[model samples]
Target chain A: MEDPMPFGTALHDRVRDEHPDLDHLVRVATRSGTRIRRRRHAIATAVTASGVAAVAIGVAMLGGSDLRSGGEPDVAVQPTAPASHPVDQPPRTRAERAHARALRALQDAPVYVDSPDWRCDQPLDEKFICTHGAASVVVVWRPAETWADYQDPAKAGPETFISDVHGQFFATVNAGPDTTHAQVVEVGEALIWAE
Target chain B: MITDAGKDSEDFGDFVRATGTQLYRQALLLTGDHHLAEDLTQTTYAKVYASWRRVSRADNPVAYARTTLLNSFFSHRRLRRSGELPTDPTLGRESSAPEDDPETRLDLLAALTILPPRDRAVLVLRYWEDRSVADTARDLGMTETGVRTRSRRALQRLRPLLGAELTERTM
Candidate 1:
C-alpha cells in the first residue's frame, strides 16, 4: 500500500540529494573541543585566584587573633572559629568574616569530575587544569554578590546556589561531549570538575 | 599506546562521515537556505563531538544527533530574531529544481520558512522524520497534547501559504 502523504517523503528525498562536504564538517567538530578547553582553563584561573585570596585573609585573621590573646598562633587551625570569642578582644571586620566563611565552604565542597582518569594539576599561579588524556576541565568561583550583580537569579538553576557563609558562587566547564548544561550546573554546586 | 583522546577523535570522524549528509539535509529543510543549513549542521556536529563519549554510548546515536540538531536550530532562531535571508546567491540556486515542476518545491520551502521555528520543527519531525507524536513531544520537550496541537496548527498555517496546487500535492 502506498503512503497517504507522499509529499513529506518526496521532500525528504529531494533534500537528501544535497550533500555537504564531510571533511569540512569533521574539521569543525574536531576544533570545537580545543576551543571549549581553552575557555574552561581561563575561567578556572580567575575563580581560583579569588578563592586563594579569601583563604589567605582567613588565615591572617586567625593568626592575628591568637597573637593578641598571648597564645602561640597555630598555623594549621581551621577558620571555623567564632570571630567574637574573647569579650575584650576586637571583633573581626565584616570582610574578614566573609572571606573566612567562603574559604571554609570551598574547602568542604566536593569535587565533581566527568571521568576517573582525569587529574587536576597542582595549583600554580592560582590556576589548575584537570586533564583526561587530551581533554581538560576547569572549575571557577564567582562570588554570589558578583553573580547577583551581573546575572539574573531567575535564570540560574538550583546548582547556582551560593555558600551560606561567604556567598561564594562556582561553575565548571570542559571540552567534552558529556559536559552538558545540566552537568555544568551540578559542577557549579560541587565546585569541582572531573571526567 | 592509543590514547582515549585519539580513539575519540577517530570515532567522531567516522560518525561525522556517516551522518553528516543526512543531518545537512534536515538542516536545509529547517533553515530553507543552503548556507544557513551548512552552518547549522556544522554547529550540531561540533556539539555532538564535544559530548562524543556519552553520545556514542547512547542506545540510539542517530536519534541523539537529530535531537542535538533540532535544539541547535531552535536556539539559533531564538538568539537571532531577524528574518534576514541568506546573502549567498549560489546556495538556494543548486537545489531549485528537485522535481519535474520546480514551483511546487519552491512553494513548499516558502511555506516552511513562514512558520515559527518551533512550529516548523513540529511539522518536520512529524512528517519528514515520520516520528510518532510521543517521540516528537519528547524530542521537542513538549507534552504529547502540545505536539498534536502544534502539528495541526502548523499544517493549517502552511496550507494557506502553500496555495491550491501545492496543497493538493500533500493529499
Candidate 2:
C-alpha cells in the first residue's frame, strides 16, 4: 500500500467524478434569489431608516445638552456599540479570511446584554464571549440574517438560556462553570438592541 | 474594484450565477436531501446578499460564500428536521450510471447519512472540497487537533462500511 495515500478518494470518485443533471439547481437558486432581493431591500431600508433615526436622536441629544457650559452631558446615551474585536491575530490560512470577517461582525453586533455588565470578546471566530463575574455568554450575530427566524432552544443546553432575537442574532447566556441559570435569564432580559 | 450600486447589483447576479450551482451541489453532498439542499443554498444566498458589501471585499469571494454555505448548514439544519434522519432512497444518489461497486457506494452513503453534522462537515471540507487540514480547521472554527479527532471519529464510523484507505491510516 502507498504511504499516506490520498484522503477520501472514494468520496471524490463518487461525488466529484459523477455528472448529474444539476441544471435544475441553478433554476431553483435563481427563483429563490428574488426573496434575497426583497430581504436586501428591506435591510437597506432599515439601515437607512436607522441612520436617519440616529441622526435625529443625535441632533436632539445635542440640542438638549449644555455642551456650551464646557461640561460633559450627564446620562449620555452611548453612541457606539460596546462590542469590539481585540483579537488582532492575523489569519494563518485562506479559510481564516472568513473567520476574520466573523470576528468583525461580532464588533458590529447590534444587540448587547447590559445587566450583567459584560465585556464581549471573540475568543473564537464567529461567536462573541461576553463575561461578567464568573459567568460568560456566547453571542452570535448574523447581520445579514434579517429574515431567518429559525430558533433551536434545545441547543441552549441545561446551563444556558438563549435569547433568539429572530433574524438578527442569538445569545447563549450562563456559559461559565460558576454562572447560574438565573443569571443567564437576567442577561437575556437586559439585552439591548443597539441598532 | 470600486463598483457603484448599479455595478454592485449586476456583480452580485454574476456572482450567484457563477457559484450557485456549485454551492447547491456542495449543500446536496452535505444534507443528502434535495429540498433541504435548496433551502440551505437559498438561505446562504440571502445571508450572503445581506453581507455583500463586506463579502465583496474578501480576498476570495467564492471561498467566502462557500464558507457561508457551510455555516448556514450548521445554523439552519436543525430548524427543518423532524427529529429523524431521512433514510429515503434518494439520500445520496446523484450517480449518472450504475456503479461497479454499487454495494460499497450504498454502504458509504448509509454511513454518511448516520454521521454527525460536525464530523460530516469535517469530512466534506477535507475530502470533497480537497481542503487542507488547516483550512478545514479554520473554516469550522476548530483547532487542528479537534479537526483530526473529529475526522478520525467520523472515519471510524464509516470504516465498517467503506474500509477506506484514509480510515485505515487513521485507525
Candidate 3:
C-alpha cells in the first residue's frame, strides 16, 4: 500500500472542495423586500409620533398654572376602597418577620447597636451597627403617617411612629457620631438594615 | 460595503445570497441529510431575518449567523429528546449512502457525525470556516481556551474514525 497522507493537507483539500454554497439561501432576503420597506416606514412613523407626543407633554407640564384659569384645582377627593392584598407575592421569610419586629420596637425611641466593620454602604434601619467594620452611620426614621399628621395641624397630638413596619415601610434614624448602631427594620415583610 | 441604512430587503437579500449556500452545506455536513439540511437552512435564514438589524451591526455577521444556525440544530435535537444523538435509522442512512471507497469528504463527514454536537460545530468553525480561536470563541459564546480545548478533543476523537492515512498525519 502507498504511504499514508498528511492529515492537514488532506483536510484542507476536503474543506476547500466541500465549502458550503451561499447564493441560494439569501433568496428569502430578496423575497421579503416589500414587507421590509413597509416595516421601515412603520418604524419611522412611530418614532415621529412619539417625539411629537413627548414635546406636547413637556410643554403642557412646563406651562403649569399659567395654562389653567384661576379656578379651583381639579383634585378629586373621592373615598376609594384600599386595594386587596396581592396574591402573587411569595410568603414572608423568618428574617423579614424579625426585621418588622425590630422596626416597630424603635419608631420614636433611639435603639443602638455597635459593629466593627460592614460591607454594605446604606443604612439598614434607624439604628445599625457595623459588625464587620469600625464605620457606622445613624439614620432618621420619619414615618409617612406621622409626617402627614404633623403636616395637618388640625389633627390631634404628636402621632406615634412606633408601629408595625407597614407594607415595606421602614426608616433609619440619624444619631450623633462615635456610636455604631444598626436597627434591623421591616416593612410588612421586606427587611432593611438601617445604620 | 453596504451602510447601516441600506435598503433592508436588499441588504438581507445580499446577506443571504452571500452566505446561504455555505450555511446549507455546513448544515448538510452536520445533519447528513439533504431534507434536514434544507430545513435547517430555511429556519436559520428565518431567524437571521428576524434579527437581521441587530446581527448586521455585529463585527462579524457571518460568524453570528453560523452560531445561531448550530445552536438551533442542537436545540432542535434537545427538544426531540433523542439523547441529542441521531437515531439509528438516521445514522444507518448516513453511513450507507455514498459508500464505495470513502473519499476524504466522506471520511470527514462520517467522522464528524460521531462527534458530539458542540465538537462537530468546533471542527466546522475552526477548519471548515477558517475562523480563528478568538472569532470561534465569540461565535460559540465560549472563551478562547474553551475553544482550544474543545478543538483538541474533537481532533483527537476524529482521528480514530478516519482512515489510517488521515489518522497518522500530524495536525
Best by DockQ: 1
Instruction: Compute the lDDT of residue A48 as modeled in candidate 3.
Output: 63
Error of 2 at B8 (Å): 5.9
How does chain B score by TM in each prediction? 0.80, 0.78, 0.71
Better of 1 and 3 by DockQ: 1
Per-candidate DockQ vs. reference? 0.21, 0.16, 0.14
lDDT tens string, model 3, A78-163?
Answer: 21212221112212764444443344334322332222122222222122322223323333345545544544435422221233
List fnat per candidate, in order.
0.51, 0.19, 0.34
Indicate the residue-level lDDT of A84 in model 1: 35
List model 1 lDDT by residue over B1-171, tens digit each: 879989998999999999898889888888887877887787778777767888899998989899889987875553232323322333233333545456556655655777778887887888888889999899999999999888777666555554423334443
Q: Rank order by lDDT, top first? A: 1, 2, 3
Greater-TM-score candidate between 1 and 2: 1
lDDT scores for all predictions?
Answer: 0.60, 0.59, 0.51
B1-171 in candidate 3: lDDT tens per residue?
866545765777788877776787778666655655665676677667767778778898887788778886874443222223432323322332233435535555556666777777776777667678898888778899999888878767655555444543434
List model 1's recovered fraction of native interface contacts, to 2 decimals: 0.51
- Alpha-carbon deviation at B164 in model 1, angstroms: 5.9
RMSD of 2: 12.8
User: Which scores greater on lDDT, model 1 or model 3?
Assistant: 1
TM-score of chain A of 1: 0.33
Model 1 Cα displacement at A110 (Å)? 36
